[model samples]
Every structure is written in C-alpha cells, then in structure tokens.
Target: MSKADVVAGIPGAIGGVPDGMASGVLAGVSPVHGLYASMAGRFFGGVGTSTQLMVVTTTSASALAVGSTLTDVDPDQRSGAIVLLTLIAGAMMIVAAVLRLGKYTRFVSHSVMTGFLLGISFNILFGQLPSLLGAPVRGSTAVAKALHVVLHPLDFDWRAAVVGLLAVALLLGLAHTRLRTVAALFALLVPMVVVLVLGWTNIGTVADTGDIPTGIPLPHLPELSSLSVPLVAGALAVTLIVLVQGAGVAESAPNPGGARSSVDRDFTAQGIGNIFAGLFRGMPVGGSVGQTAINQSSGARGRWGGMWSGIWILVILVALAGVVGRVPLPTLAAILMVAAARSIDPDRLVAIWSSGAISRTALVVTFVATLLLPVTAAVGVGVGLSLLLQLNQEAIDLKVVRLRVHGDQLVEAKAPTALSDNEIVILDVYGSLFYAGARTLQAKLPDPDGAHDPVVILRLRGRTSVSATFLHVLGDYARRLDALGGRLYLSGVDPRIRDVWTDDLLHAQGIHIEFFAATSTLGESTLAAYADAEVRVHREQRP
Candidate 1:
C-alpha cells in the first residue's frame, strides 16, 4: 500500500474502532469481538470485493439481530453460539452468491427498506437505553426494557448516566466543529478520564464484562453440540440483513473512477469476511455504510485503504488492549445511541406517506411488524407486503385500449357505445397479464353484442409470458366468439409466449384462434385480421 492509502485508512480505522466496539455491545458479546470482526472483515472482505471503497465491518442491524437470536443461551455458551451462527450465516451468503441471487435484491423496495431501517433505529435507541442510563434493565424487547427502566428509576446509576450523557453531548457538539473526524474518539476518551479521575466505582467499564484478549484470536471451529433450530434461524436472519445492508452500501459508495461494482461479487466477499470473522470468534460482519462513506470521503483510492484500515485496527488491538479495558460502557452506549438516532429519517417516512396509500400502508405495516416481531419474522412480513404492493400496482395499471387505422397511422380510438352488425374491433392489451391483471383485462374488454360474426383482434407484441388464468380468459372469449360464428385473432404474438401457449389445443376446441408473428407491424396484423373478418361476415350472410 502507498503512503496515501495509509493516510486515507487512518480516519476509517479510527472511526471503525469505536463503531465496532459499540456493535459488540449491541451483539451482547465482548467489545473486543467487535474490533476483531471489523479487522477480519475489512482485510478479507476488501480483498474479495468489487467495490474498492466499501469497508466491510460490524453493522448495527446485524449486531442487534445476533443479540436477539442468542438471548436465551447461557452467558458462557453465548460466545460459541455467536461464532457458530456467524459461520452458518456466512455459508448461507456463499450459497446465495453461487446461486446468483443478487438480482433479487431489487425486490427489496425502497419503502420496505426505509421501514426496516426505522425499526432498527428504534430498536437501537431502546435497546441501548439501559446502558445509557446505567440501569440493570432486563427484558427481551427494547420496549420492554425501556418500560422496566421507567418503572424502576431508582436502580439507575448516576455516575454512569453522567458519563453517557456527557459523551453524547461531546459527540453531537463536536460534530459541528473541526474536530469532527476525531469526535467519537474524544467523546469516548474524555468521559473515560472523568470516570477514572473522580473514582466512580459505580460506573462499569469494558473490563467488567470480560477480559480483552491481548492478541488476535486463534482460528477454531465453534462447538456444534449445542446447535439448535433457533441458532440456524438466527443465522438465516443475519444473512438476509447482511445482504440487504451490503446492497445499500454498494449502491451509495461509488468507485472513484465511476466503474460499476458487481453486487454478487460483493456478496461473496462479505461471505468470505464472515467466515474468517467466525473462525476468529468475532461478530458477524457486512459492508458498513457509515465506514464506507468515511473511507470514500477520506480520499481512499483503492481496496488497499480498507486493507490498511484492518491492519491498523490489528495494531491497536495488540498495543492498546489494556487501555480499551478501562473505557467506560456508558461512553460506548452514548456513541451507539447517537449513531442510532442518526439512522432514523423522519423525512423518508413522510415521503413514503405522501407517495400513495398503498405505498404508505406497506411502509407502516413493515415498520410496525419490525418493531413488534423479531428481525427474522419482520423480514418475512416485509417481503409479503412488497408482493402485495406489486400486485396492487399491476391490478390498477392494467388497461385495454381500442386502436383504429386512420390513413397511414394506427391511433388510439375510443370504444363505441355500441357495435354494428359485421363490425370488427381491434384492441391493444397493455401491462402485465399475470393473475389479477389478466382478470382486469377480461373485465375491461368491449362486449360483442349487436354484431353478427364480429371479430376481435388483440395486439400483444411486447408481452413475453402468459399465465394460465390469462389463457383461460382467452379461451373463454374465443369460445364466445366462435358460438357467434366469429373469430379471435391474436396479433403480434411474441415468440416466447407463442412457444408456451399450445396453439393446437385451442384449435382442437373449434375456437378459430389465429396468431400473427410478433415481428409483424400492428397495422399489418390489424389489416389482415380485418380482411378475414370481412370474409367471415360474407360467409355468414350467404343463404
């Protein structure tokens, strides 16, 4: 790595240390695990990732998810469970990569993601409230914990609260000044010094939780004896959270030279990072939006910046393990609270509300579901809501417009209030023809009454696929027309659809359905169908 890369990595490494430490607390693991996770993720993930600026590290969402998953495990067994879960999640990510499921990330609609992030933000704030107030609040959900603190305020430790509040103030206040780069560090350090100088015995430090290992953790496999369904489920949840969050980071942090990054490659990179992190007994990691942004703004030119950031973190872990132990828990809690608060975007919520009722409902349902349910369950709810939203939109947008040949041009024509004997109608079907949309098209079609042997020509040039429901509708319409001694012509049929449509089956039913090539112009197909309709009318008139 060049000198410039090292310089650029300094800010990222500095910011990552505290952020990772905070994530560990969120994950209900030792703070040093967070540091190890960041280091392992950056080095391993950076080497494999397509996006040079992306910094893979511990994220708040994954951390909270881990904590929720392992809440019931024995304290001593929790660390091992965490490692096993991370490994499982990493394996899932690798499977997703090999299956090339990255394109499915597009299905995660903006409203759903917005709602999820909002829910996670709330979780973080409420989840960290106990630490922020230095209260021994015990509950499963963030709301329950907050309620516990409120109901028993006397249990709060004033010294720890002071440290947390001061850290928050410093972090928020210094962000507006020139010291913003080092603001988090200062916020942590100043509060620690105050607690130490004043001899605040009631305040808990990192050492209170567990000893900080002086060197890198040796690679080892977590015990598989205690593995259970819940652990596997949690790993699946973590994998999804990582993929979604990583996609966001990849999208937001563009390469300096403007080359597009491959989402699947990045997915594989994060999987590799998680595997190493698990082996090192570190927390699960993904592409961190905050850290990546810092790396970019710090003028990082290539992947080496992220690689060096991991190296610097390793140095810190070895040289400053003793100092890290002395850092107060509330200070870290304060940092996390501020970061969580920043993640919640009220403006985005308002935008979702104003977009439309369907979109607004999706946002609200996902948000509420995420708040009330575990992160894993909430993902299912969000995906279901997204599907419903898509169906609703297709149902509303499906249309069948009448077309007429006016001189050399084929233009849209208003459907006549009534049809005349021997008249032919041409219709253009638009939008998706799947499920509910097909029903909408069937209902919107003009009636064949008042016309003797009337023929209907449907233009379907752009559609690539047809559902069974749509085919059934077409068959029913063709039979109705056939009974009237008329015919139905499908003009401009896409080859792909025609291949799947089984034309022989419909012809065997005496429906008299004729299909025009997709390459045929709409005017040519309509003229051909019109001539055939004229021939049918003449035949019907013969006596």
Candidate 2:
C-alpha cells in the first residue's frame, strides 16, 4: 500500500509481461490475452488472497492444459472455447473454496509434484523450440515436436536463432549483476532493438500475431453451443493443475509481515481472478511461484505490490503498445526456455530416484506420462500415482505388536512359539484399518494354528471407527478361533466399533466373542481376559 510497495512492483510487472506473452503463445492464444490474464489475476488475486506478495498470472502448466483441451475446437472458435473453459475452471475453484477442500492439496505428495513439475519444465522447453529456432515444427506431444526440430535443423532461420541466443545469454548473464531484477526486460528489449536495427523483417515478432491491442476489452460471455464433454473434463483438469501449482506458490512465498496465509482464501482469490480473465477473453491464471518470487525479492511489502504489478501492465498495454508490438517471438521463447530450465531441480529428481523403488517408479511414470500424453491426462496419471504411493506407504507402516504384563509394568514381547491349552495371547493393533491397510493387517494376522483351545485377545485402543473391511477380517478370525474351541476377546474396543457386532447374530453362529472398554489399563484388560480363559479351561476339564 506504500510507495515502496508500488516501486517494488514495477520491476515484477515489467518482467511478467514477456512471461505472459510466452505462455499465451504456448496456449495458442493472442499474446495480449496472456497480458490480460496476468493483469486481471494480479489485481483481483491481490485483493482477495491472504498472502501479501503472492502474484497470480499465466503459468506454463495451466496454459498447456488449456491448449491441449482446446485442440479439437475450430480455429475460429478456439478463443471462445478457451474463455468458457477458464470460467468453468474458476467456478470449480470457488466451489472448492466454499467446500474447504484446500486442505486436500496436501494429499498431492512431494514426489508427484516433483514429477509433474519436471514434466512441465520439459514441456515448455520442447514446446518453444520451434519458435526459438524460427521453424514451424508441428507435432502433438512435446517429444514429437522436439524430434521434428531435431530432424529438420536445416529449416531453422539463423537470424531468429541469433536473436534467441542473445536473449538467453543476456538473461542468464545479467542475473549475477545488481540489475538482476530487470534482467528479463533488458533481455527482451535488447533483442527487439537488434532485430529492428538489423532490418530482420524475416524474423517472427509479436507484430506477426496481428496488431497489439491497447487497454482492456469489455466483458462478454462465451458461446456454449460448441461445448463438449471433453471440454468440461479439460476444465476440471485445469482446475486441478492450478490448485496444485497454487499451493506450491503459497508455500514458497510467505507473507513479508510473517502472518499466516490461508490456502483456501488464496484458492478463492485465484478463482475470482480466473473469472474476470475469462470474461475478457484471457488465458486461465493461477498463483505463480516464479512471478511471486520476483515480487518478494524486489522488496514487495504487501499485496499492493501485486496490485501495482497489474496496474503497471495495464499502463504499458495502453501507452506502450507500439514498443511491445516490435518484440521478437524468438526472444520471448528464449526467456521462457530460461524460465523453464530454472523450474527443474536435478538434485530433487536424484533424491526421488534414490528414495526407493515405489518413489522412483512413481516419478518416472508421472514424468513419462506428462511427456507422452496430453497435459490433462498427465495430471490424472500424477494423481493416480500419488494415491497408489500413499496406500503402499500406509500398508507398510501398519503394525501389530504383542504385549505382556511383567510384574506391575506392561512390556513388549515376542509372540509365543506355541500356546498351552486355554492360554491367552494379547496383541495390540496400530495404524489405519482402512482399505489396503485393512487387507494388509488381515494378511499379517498370526495364525491360531498349533494351539489347543487358545483364547486370543486383540487390543484396539484409540481407534474411533472400524472399517467394513476390518470388520469382515474380524469375523473371519472369530470363525477360525471358534473352530479351535476357543473364544476371541476384543479388549479396548471403542463403543462405536462394538456397535458393529450383533449379539443375536453371534449367538446364532455359535461364535464366542467378548468385548472390553479401551479405558481400562492394558495390564488390567489382559489379566481379566486371562482369568476368563483359566475359568473356561477348568470348567471344561472338570469332567
């Protein structure tokens, strides 16, 4: 809100324009739409988000998802379809915020994010190769396009390549200097001037995409007559990509004042931004880690920096349209390539690869899917991989330990090699009993074999609910004990779990089942169950 905040934002705004332009090209929309998205997102998102420095703008991942989704639409109708898709994705984000689903973002594990981002980085690099080389490389996937560029190097325009390489060199070389914040601006402008001075009319520039529009467009509803099931699915996919990437931004860019930011609030803010952006025929926008980082490092004091960033972009569009129009496409592509390279972390990928087989496989599969499949489908693959990894970890962590009362203290002990007649065994269950964990527990349960009427006691303390799968397992175990002329004692059973059992059904099946409260001490529960076993043994032997 201060002058300093506004001043800090100027650099970020200048840097963000080329980024937005690059992403717009990636999304197959006018570069100006990217500027519109960035402007709307920063202004509205700054007003609504909890974080002071987080900037919402066009991102490679969301742009790619949007582009892939609109591929089937006719060229004339693609812009309208993109607008509708943005609106739908924004609506979904708002619904998610209302439902308080922001906490669910934590379920997207680190490995999955690593793979997803690596894939996006590669996508951006390969997707821009043709523009960088000034060649018309066409293909469906990043790999295919990359292969095309590699095979047809003869078609590349040397002048455009020189411009792109110069831009890249300046951008990277200036980072170590004091003017690092404005590196992108210099990188873009220097190339534009060189191309203009050299009379390189053959090079493709932003002007080639049609005249640059000044100021914002009026809000209009997109036509929905051409909407399809695939479009809706693509919107959902974009929503997911935005949320995941937004969460990363929120975590990476903390508020300057040290106040905690709410992920749900940020989610709603992004939703509002997207809605306005779509209304103006802009690409979908979300929390951007790169731009927000730049905003913070440039001394952004509050949300005003983000708001000012949008204001500055608007001012440029209105007053400097001619200057922006002359910017070379190869220069923008080179800047994006540098940005994409920065997104990937070789150390993190290596750590994930060395973590374990499951982590390695999940990372590899998600990365490969992102390269080979559409962006939307790649997101699906990442989510599926994360779920499988979670289940596998849970199954491994599930434990069942044996306990014994040594004098006055309860002590952990190994399971007995064999049980005497009417001897009772007390086992404590730990971890989850849901889904795969339940199956794992069932499989790992010790057999009641080689025992004479051995009574088994299971201690399930602190569990609030019993899953149906777990209940089935218990039923099967009870039948096994009943066959051995022994009873099953479920000690420390919460009332909720005990409710799952029916006395009449147990009696009809002649299954001996006993329940005990978890409130009792473990030693007390085990001793009481042991006393009952002794009494039963004496009564049976009396004959």
Candidate 3:
C-alpha cells in the first residue's frame, strides 16, 4: 500500500505543476499561488478526507470564481484579497460540515451542475482565447473578449499564435500515447523551448502575470481591514462552488476500501485544505476531478497518495521555481483551453437536452448564466435553478391513489375526481407532502364541493411528521367535508403524530379529524377506520 501511494503520488505531482499554474492563471493570480494551493490542499485536505484517493487541489471552477470575485480589486491588492477569500470560504465550509449541510448537495440537481460546469468550460475557453492568440483585446466577459479577438485578427501576435497552436497540437497528438500521463509537460517544454531558443521576446510569458517566489512562502495573515460585504458574499459563492464540486469528485471515485465516504467529513477536509492554502499564501482549492483521476490511475489506494503528492509538488516548486517564470503565457493558455474543452461532456449535454422540459430549462438557463454572468453570480443562478428543480420534482412526485377492499385484499386504483353522497373513499398518499408537494395534493384530490356526506379516509401509515403546509391542506379538506356532514379520518398514522401538536392543531382549526393508530398488521388500522365509517353512514341513512 505504501509503495502504491508513492507510485501514485509521482504522477499526481508531475501533473500538479502545469495543472496548478493553469488554475492560478485561470484565477487571474500569480501561477505560484496555484502551486501553493496544490501543495496545501493535497496535504491538509487529504489528511482526513473521507474519500481516500480524492485529490483536493485548485479547480477551474473555484479559480474562475476567484477571478470574478477580484475582478474589481486593484491588481496589487488581489493577492491579499485572494488569501482572505480562501480563508473565509474555508471557514464557511467548516461551518457547513458542523451543521451537517452536506446531504443537501444532492438537491442541487444533476441538470443544474451539468449546466454550470458547461458554462465554466465555455467561460474558460473563450477567456483564454485572447491569451492563446496573443491578441490585444478588452471586454467585460470572456465571450466578449474572445469576440473582439476574432472580429479583429490584426491585433493578434502571429508568433504567439504559432506557439499556442503548436502546444495545442502537441496536447491532442500525445493524448492517446503511452506518454499521455506527461503530455502536458511535454507540450509545455516543447513550445517554451522553441520560443526560448528563437528569442521570441514578443511572446508574453509567466513573468508578465505576477512574480513567482523561488522557495516556499511563509504563512501570512489577511488584511482584516479589507473585509467588506462584497468580499463576504464572494466567499459564500466560493464555498458553494467548492462543496458542490467536491461532492461530485467523491461520487466519481468511490473509496476502494468499500466504506461509504461521509460528505460532511469531506467538506471539513476541504475546509482544512483551504485554510492551509490561505495561510501559506495560496489560492482557493477544492476536490478536482482531473487530479483525482490521475491519483486513481496512478495506483493510489489511500489518502497518502494525495498527501505525498503535496510533498512532491513542493519539492518541484522549490527546484524549478525560476524556470516557471520563463514559460510562455500562450502555452499555459493552450493547456487550459484543451483541458476545458475536454471538461465539457457532450454526452451529458445531449442527455440533459433529452431529459424533459424542466431539465432542459435548467440546463440552458444555467449554461447561459455561466457565460454571461460573473462567476459568483453564475453560482447563485445555479443554486436558484437547483431549488426550482427540486420543488418542481416534489410537485411531480406526489400522487393520490384510491384504495378499495375487494374481499380480504385492498385494490389500488386512480383516485376519483368527485365523491358521491353516502360514500366512503380511502386515499393513500405517496411521495412527500411538504410545500409544493402538499399543494399538488390539493389539486389532485377529489373535489368535495359537490359531494354530500362523503367520508375521506387518508392512509398516512409511515408518516412520522407533517409540514405546516400539509397540515393546512388537511385542515381545509376536513373543513370542506364537515360542512356537508361528512368526516375526514386519518388511519394507520404513526403514534408520534397523536402526541404532537398536530393533533391539537387539527381541532383548533375548527375541524374534528378522527385519528387511527397504526397496527402491526398492514392495513388493519385502515380497515378498522373503514368499519367505523360504515356504522356512521348506516346510522345517518336510518335517521
């Protein structure tokens, strides 16, 4: 296992350099910050991460988020702002873990995430076009800037274009070969060497972005006075992006030990990683899908693979820090463009398009928002899309079925649209009865407006609790039935409901709802309630 960790760590470390620098470039920060994040995140986040082989590191999504966050800040102050943002986002993650909010990540919806990721990819691709083309362009968004470069090709430096294209060609060429593991390094080295040897001084290089320190940076504190409303909000956005992406990473690579990974614990692990990253003067980091794939493919069996990769990356950074500054900006741009291109999964996009109207809407809206809006704003839009989808699903999921006793067995059928006089109707509710679900039930249930003396027996057998909205729906139904001398009976209900305020609340709402406790035998309580309803109907008829 130790040997496997060491073996896996090597490839991960090797990829971390270019990958890390690319993330930093994405974040609009110094490339070294990405390296620092790679080291801190892998070491600190992996220490107690639930997903053993999941490599916590700087991710494109988070990097884009950081770029959007500091878009307005002065360049000289971005470093401090980035550090502060990382720490704040990390703290937020820890709070989420403590509050056990990880389970809600599923509610984000696959369609929303897919759209957001697609948006991030396109944003990266379009944003890097200017750098890749070495074209002087200015625009508010990536798409806008790329358009300027395309609309006016005269602004492009042909020399830089050639180098960038060469790197891209190399990436595509080496993708399928045995050297694919180190393809990025090869691409970087080849194009950079060509430019260096030819003395293509016109090509933009890493030195133009920011200064890269020669050794590991010392821990530093963020500027407390710089905290503001926008900064906090940006931190919140970063927190959402990382946690959600981390959840996907955990799902992508299941733990090899057969143990289910705890999402909350993973959240805390990422929090620890970001804290260390900030303290060490690094950028924000999170669970990276590409890096995790490298870890697994390289034979990592446990957390040690990620931890060792951190050490290896640090060693590399210290050894080759000076050379990194000489790497052409166009090469890094090409690497990022290729990576982002691959990140957009066409199959998933096609599936989302075919899923249904609701899913398609989510995907399209989120995707567009990602391209047009700032990274933080796009995140908010994604979250809004997820919530809307969840509510919509709840509405669609609710079902009302009628149950009839045919001899000793109960047969299920579609619920009636209206009830008849002197009738006994048994309804079984399926799916959630909260919020939109309960409102959907209101529409699906039979109309009591025209019915006289119609007894409604609702089976709530496994229900342990009821939402206020559902309770209100029940009260309204009971009141309508009571007006016609009919009664609403609840049978096979969980015992706890009887002791809760729900029982008293029903009476307080001016309706007497008969409650039947569930029995060991299935449908026994319902049958008993039915028998009592029969007696009441028969007595009314005789009178």
lDDT of each: 0.85, 0.84, 0.90
| Cα lDDT of model 1 by residue, 1-543, tens digit | 678879988888888899999998998888878988998999988998888889999999899888888888898888888889988998899999999999988777789878887888888888888999999979878888888998999999888889999999999999888888788889879998998899997788888889888876578878897599998999988998899889989889888788999889989999999999988888899999888888887778899899889989998888888989999999899989899998877888788889997778778888888788888788778877777777777789987778887766678977654445666788887788898888887888767665667778888877788899988888888887777777788987778887887668667765568887666454776667666766877888899
TM-score of 3: 0.98
TM-score: model 1 vs. ground truth:
0.93
TM-score of each: 0.93, 0.92, 0.98
Each candidate: how many clashes? 0, 1, 0
Please identify model 3 stretches exceeding 4 Å from their true place: none
Q: For model 2, what is the C-alpha lDDT against the true structure?
A: 0.84
lDDT of 2 by residue, 443-509 (tens): 7776877666877788777887877777778778888877877778887777887676678766675
**Top-lDDT structure, candidate number:** 3
Model 2's number of clashes is: 1
Give candidate 2's error at residue 314 in angstroms. 1.6
Tens-digit per-residue lDDT, 3-112, candidate 3: 88988898899888899899888988888889899999999999989998889999999999999988888888888888899999999999999999999999898998
Badly placed stretches (over 4 Å) of model 1 are 415-421, 448-452, 505-512, 520-527
**CA error at residue 230 for candidate 2, angstroms:** 1.5
